[model samples]
Target chain A: MDQFTLNLIVVGITFALYIGIAIWARAGTTAEFYAAGQGVHPVLNGMATGADWMSAASFISMAGIIALAPAGGYEQSAYLMGWTGGYVLLALLLAPYLRKFGKFTVPEFIGDRFYSGGARLLAVICLIVISVTYVIGQMRGVGVTFSRFLEVSTDTGLYIGAAIVFAYAVLGGMKGITYTQVAQYVVLIIAYTIPAIFISLQLTGAFLPQLGLIGTHTASGVEFLTKLDQVVTELGFRAYTSDSPNMLNMFLFTMSLMIGTAGLPHVIIRFFTVPKVSDARTSAGWALVFIALLYTVAPAVGAMARLNLTTTMWPAAEQGNALDGPAITLAEIDSNPELSWIRTWEKTGLLGMSDLNGDGQIQYFAEPPAVTAANKALAAATAALAAAGPDADRAALLAEVAAATAARDAALAEATIGGVSLAERGWVGNEVTRLDNDMMVLANPEIAALPGWVIALVAAGAVAAALSTAAGLLLAISSAISHDLIKGSINPNISEKGELLAARIAMTFAILVATYLGLNPPGFAAQVVALAFGLAAATIFPALMMGIFSKRINKEGAIAGMLVGLIFTGVYIFLYKGWFFIPGTNMLADIPANYLFGISPLSIGSVGAVLNFAAAFLVSGMTREPPHEVQELVESIRVPRGAGSATGH
Target chain B: MADKSSANAYWAANLRTIGISLVVWFLCSFGLGIILRPALRGIHVGGADLGFWFAQNGSIYVFIVLIFVYAWRMNRLDLEHGVEE
Candidate 1:
């Protein structure tokens, strides 16, 4: 069978399975709609949380970023560490206490704990903003996966994804979503692991991808890291195993991601579906174990994918010529059976090529001027310093030039002709300049020449990851609007049936908004989503932490702190990301050199969090203490006994 | 007065456990992974350095272990404080 037909069958079966689970676990009551009747077993909730937490970005885009090391370095591993590490904060500090509080929604807890309607409303606003921003990325993820694997336009793909999420979420609510997510987690992990294991065995003769990552390549017998370090340096990129250029930024970025992970409302709400505080803690651990299964193997997958891509394009020639193999001519791309994957991916336009100098052959290499100029300059500088006296500055310059020369020589050796300089030769510029980072995982199986069903399984896995996250975010948004906004603030007398209807309506509206954003994504949409992290870190995490940890904080203090955090982080992000993300309206440059205290806008969330803690403490010191009953309530949540049941209304 | 004192004592014990665990968490991720990364690079594991291992995989493993320890120890602490669910 053809690849297209196989992809359709696999993706179709997965969708049918999701819909079947949704129908079987259809929610009837308001309680079931909101918190799955608060009866989810710890392990089941952990599996559901795993699906919820590993969004399209984690499953699809992260490994690509790690492999590509875009903008030069492996610093993007902060995302891996920060995201996973944040769960520790959630599991240990936040989850049990919030579960003990027995609230239906995150905002409801904030409102009740602070004893203020306004605080509840503010939390609702924050939750809506975070979830909505997050869902846009998921929608885009669904669109990308569908367009590539199923051969549809991005918009049609998004609509298809939106419809699937709506059917399951609107009918079954949290109950249906919980079960579907479990199936999704299983599907995604298998899809992710199978390709990785296959690729690992192919590259290194190791069964486990994790071991393969650090083992010797079977063909070259070179340590995987050593081989990769040679390849990337030859291509003018940093080594795969090198340290981040800026340690401080890596440290802060990881911290921001960790706390931001804890603060995200969709993830926190998953714990509320479990029965007890103890279950909340256990579930968090299980979720990590599930998440780690992917996390540990990702680095291996990334390295192996990078190596495979390099070997395919610039294969190690049979005659031991390391520099250039017989180039794959344009005509051969269409005719060569082994080269069919290239033609297939090229149709999606993510993988593109053009003969720059009208040469029939494709030359995927570092730009000539960039490689030679740095090499010549460093060589001249080193010679000059060596001629001078042995001063401290000269010694430092010597060391720097030594590394640069070594890297340049590796490139030169690869591009060497029989005494002919690469510049003197006429060759096309790097033919593949548009390698989108998100394409790495999707294209891995095809690149490695895996069977069609494995590729099909990858397609299903991408869809599952996107759909599971989209459902969780939609649930969070709907709960906020129906439970926090309409019932808690606008209409306290709303009946259970009325609230359920409102929840479904809110979900429909949220899906539409997310689809619209996915279709017409703004230029700064990526940066703006980072702002969502900043807002979550600044507002929700601090407010939730203070509510539990401090008895002195009053309603006025909580409201004041959240407002300050919300506005401060929001305005700072808007200033650089364009006013409200409007194109061509940014007041300051978004680069690190332009940031306050050398913190990039992406890492500014951690700074916003510190400001939040400081502002809350100051505000609470000046305000009245919480009422005696509220203080006792804090005490009760602190201990694990007498936990109230999580109710729907 | 005695009941209030005991409750404070239980909270303190809980805080101590949290503090100690958090310290280990910080050491593994931020300390060993980032700040102390270069220092740990001299130590090799398999084909990679310790810092890269910590950043990519070790910290995640530590995080999972830490949560289970916190859960198991906290549950025992709850029972001892007469607050078991």
Candidate 2:
């Protein structure tokens, strides 16, 4: 079969399976739809959580980002650190309490805790913010992967993706999604690991796979990482495994992802599907095990991809000459159709190359800025400032300026060896990005000349990654709308059937809004994704933890703390990102240069979390304790024994 | 013995597990991973800082151990206190 047909078949089979599972597992009642009738096996729930948690970011892009960046190992470590760490909070603090409260949704718990409808409403709003922002990104990811592999327009891909999601999720409810997600988990992890194993064997000569990462480069006595650092630095970039410019920011950014991972509604809800609290604990461990399989392999994939690209760029003997064959010319892309993602993406203006020095080919290089470039009219001006009238010392300093500018300009001009410039590649040591981090993974397989099956595996992985997360987010959004908004607030007398219908309607509308945002993603969508973690950490995480752990905290205090955390994090991000991150309206570009105390906008969410804890604690001190009755409830939530399956009202 | 403090024993057993698990969680997450990272810099495993491993892999492994340990100990305690199913 033709490659496209083969890809179509693979995707078709997976979709059919999902739909079939949905049909087989259609939820019969409100209980079944909302919490899978609280009968899901802990192990199975862990698998579903794995699929839910491993969004497009984890499955589709993480390894690529790691592979393509030189500082990938240590810098990108937050992807591992924060994501896994958040579970500590979830498994220990939040899961059991929420499960015991036996609410249909997060906002329900918030409402009961605060003794105010407004507090519940406030929580629902945060849920919408975090979930919608998260879902839209997943939708966009699905569109792109489908467009490329399925040979359809992004809109068509989205429409089909939406329909497939609706069939299983809307019809199947949590039970359907649960079993299908187990299937998806299998598909996704297999697709993810197979490619990793192939790449590892090709690179390291080891088959145990994980150990292959640290296995020596058999031909070269030098360690693989040492060789990588040398090669990247030679091309004018930071060494792989070296620190990023903003270490503290990276740390905070990582922490935000961790806390966010725990706070995400889809992930947190999975724990509740199981029958008991002890089961919940074991399930979390399994979920981590499933996640760790990929997490551990990701760095190796990143390292190998970097090596692969560098080696491809310079197929000749090391250090023989800086320029190898020839850098990729515009004509090559113009002539060949397959080499088009670069050219097509360049129009987005994130990627660009112009003939500098009037070179016929795009001589991309890692070059310094105008201030550093010498002769370099700017450099000459600086030389003039440093000049003593015609003195030899002045001449030497001028020469030094020229030499420095030469180096800087060479760095500034994305370096071209032969046909490939270091800047054109992912791992070039030092240059501002002109490409989305997502592109690195997309480009690597093609760069490596992997077989069609391997390429097809990547396609399936991307779709699965996108679909799994989309289903999870859709479920979260729908539950919030139907369970919290309708049953809890708008129509408390709504029948079970009415609530189920409302949930289906909510999901359909959510898919549409998510689709619209995917196409017209806000400027800071990627940055906002990381920010979702922060919001979850700061606002929702604290409230959930306090609700179960501290009986003395009154509804008023928890409400006040959540409101403070939510508004503060939102405003802080908005002030720099814009009013709602409205591209040009940003008060300042929310980068390290413009940040408060160099705490990256990404990491500021951690501060927000801390503030939430403080505000809640301090505010609680001023309020009367929850009724003594509340203290007993808190005690009941902490223990695993004596609690049976909670029937949600 | 007087009453065997059935209620307190059951709650206490649960609390002991939570307390122990929390300590391990703190030590693995904030302790070795972040705060003690500087102190443990000299310790390296397979090219990464020992703290890095603890943060990334080791701590998670420890969490699993702590959890299983908690489950077993809690199960035993629960039966002793006549709380287990």
Candidate 3:
């Protein structure tokens, strides 16, 4: 069959299966819809969490950032450090306690714990900001991945993704999503692994899969990773694994991601689905194992694709080449449709081309000024110094010449070449951003020339990834609206059926809102994703952790902490990102310029989280402690075995 | 008070194990990745600095081992404290 037909058939079948699971496991009661009735098996819940945790960004964008950056940037590790570290805080502080509290939702926990309606409302606002920004980012990623891979426009792909999520999420509820997410994890892991296996065999000639990456290359005796590092570095990018940003920024960014991950409403809610506290502990371990299978292989895929693309471009060099490849030659890229992403993106102006010598072949060498007056003056100075003695600074002459040569060479070289050009490298360090990071995982099969089904599996994995996370967020939003707003605060007398209907309506509204954001995405979808972590870091994490650990923390303190946390981090990010993440309108122009003590806004969330904790602690310390009964409850949550049953609220 | 001592022992043991595990966790992602990356530059793995391995893949591998240790050590700690279900 043709590639398109095969992709359709494979992707369609996967969609049908997801919808089938949703219908089979559909929620009947409000509890079932919200928390899957808290009866999920720990191991199964682990798999579901993996699906919930690995979004379109994880499945589509992360490896791309790794591949594209080769050099780690300030915000790039947001995927690695943030996503993984969040679990530590989750398992240690949040999960067992929240599960012990037996609350229906995070806001409900705030309401009961703080004994103030204002605390609950503050939580809702924080949830709306964090979850909406995060969910919208996920939606945009889903749309972009779907459009590119599924052979449909982004609008069609988004609608298709939304419909699929609705069919399962609205129908199956959490129970359905939980069971289906396990299957989705299986589908996605297999889809991701297969291409890696083929590409590994094609490149390394070792078939064992995992060993192919680090093992010596079959074609040449060189290590695969070593060759890849050398190839991209010669092209003027940082080495794959060894790239570093400012230490303070890196430290804070990782912490922000971890805090954000731990704080994310959708991911945390997944833990509530499991049966017992002890099971919750075991389940977390299992989720990591399931996720690690991909995380371990992802870096390998990234390094290997870098090598593979270099070899393809520089075919004459055979093994890995030091020379400029076909990708640099304007004639080769423009004439070849297969390599047209280079041209398509070049027109976006993020990638540009220049012919210094009017040569049709674009040279991509380091173009330090072939010579400079400084070089001449320095040469005269060096000649004098050398004549004077051995006093000449050889290092200075070399560096100056190299610097001058690099500038001229860079100017002489094509302003842009293909296969992720030199300039498209970092996170907010440059003037414009590149979407190459998002394309990393999605473009894997095509880059490797794998089979149609393999490519479609990537497409399917992207959809499964995007759809599952979207459904989870919709569930969180609708739950807050129906349970917290309608039942708890606004009505106080909502019927079960009425609440369920409202939940479904609220879900529809949430999906519509998400879809609008996806279609005409708020100007800074990428920047917003980072801020989602920041906002979560600043607000929910402090409240939840404080509530469980400290009896002195009161409703007023929690509300005050969340509001101050939101405003502090929000204003800092807006001032730097722009009043509202619009690019040119940024109040602060320099990335390092605006960062406090050289801490990037992307990493500022960690500082905000700390501030949140301090504000809550100080404010609570000054006020009254929880009632005696609440203190006993806090003590009870500290242990594992004496956990109470899930409350209906 | 006697019951509280055993309870304290159990909790303390669990806390100790997590404390040590978190130490390793922090060292791998933070210590190696950021603070001590420069110091460890001379130690090469594959073709990159040792710190690079820690940042990209080593920390995650260590994290896997850390969780499993917590599980094993906690299971034993449970027996000592009489807290195991």
lDDT of 1 by residue, A365-459 (tens): 55666555656766687777777765557767777788776766555545634345454555524677567666788899988989989999999
TM-score of each model's chain B: 0.92, 0.85, 0.90
The ten-residue window of minimal lDDT in model 2 chain A covers A424-433
DockQ agreement of candidate 1 with the native complex? 0.59
Per-candidate Cα lDDT values, in order, are: 0.79, 0.68, 0.69
* Superior candidate under lDDT, 2 versus 3: 3
What is candidate 1's TM-score against the reference? 0.89
The number of the candidate with the highest TM-score is 1
Best by DockQ: 1
lDDT of 2 by residue, A2-98 (tens): 5677777777787788778877887766467667626776777778788888887776566656655544455666666677767766766677557
Report the C-alpha lDDT of model 3 over A311-395, residue by residue, as the tens digit.
5455533454645334346677677655664443343222344553444544433222222333344446545545654666777
lDDT leaderboard ranking: 1, 3, 2
